[model samples]
Target: MTEHTSIRIRVTGHVQGVGFRAWTQARAEELGLWGWVRNVADGSVEAWVSGPAGAVADLVEALGHGPAAARVAAVETGPADAASDAAGAGFRILR
Candidate 1:
């Protein structure tokens, strides 16, 4: 079954202030994902990605590379938080 699912990914390394969030937003939209990406105080980029299984997987793969300007060190993907609705609206950048 191709049901919707949410994946929360925490990207480590030099991922802040280097257009990571914008890149993630663009990639997520390209994959037709529905979620958001934000910068955490812990110096990591966090993303809430939700969509089809394939799309979510693709998003994770993209995060592994990020923008050409980004030097992605690591990307951790797993189930989203219980508070996050798997049936959210669309992909975006959180404040």
Candidate 2:
């Protein structure tokens, strides 16, 4: 049976202020994933995702290329706590 999985992705390189977070929000919604994307002061983008394993994998692959303006260097994904309340239904952009 398919199971729900939570993923935390830290994207390195030029991924801030270039609509990367917004793009991720849209992408996650398109794949019916629940998550939140945010920009960090360290010039990276972080996201907490929860959904079907396949969809989460797709999201991570997309994040590596991000928006046209974003120069994504790397993407790291891992298991997240099941009880973590990091995001609500539908993808949102965090401050």
For model 1, the run of ten residues with the poorest summed lDDT: 82-91
The C-alpha TM-scores of every prediction are: 0.90, 0.90
Superposed on all Cα atoms, the candidates' RMSDs to the truth, in angstroms, are 1.4, 1.7
lDDT of each: 0.86, 0.86
Residue pairs of candidate 2 with colliding backbone atoms: none
Which runs of model 1 end up more than 4 angstroms from their true locations?
A: 86-88
Lowest lDDT block of 10, candidate 2: 79-88
What does candidate 1 score on TM?
Answer: 0.90
Q: Once model 1 is optimally superposed onto the true structure by TM-score, how far is the C-alpha of residue 4 displaced, in angstroms?
A: 2.6
Q: What's the alpha carbon RMSD for model 2?
A: 1.7
12-54: candidate 1 lDDT, tens digit per residue: 9888888999989888888888888899999999988888888
Clashes of each: 0, 0
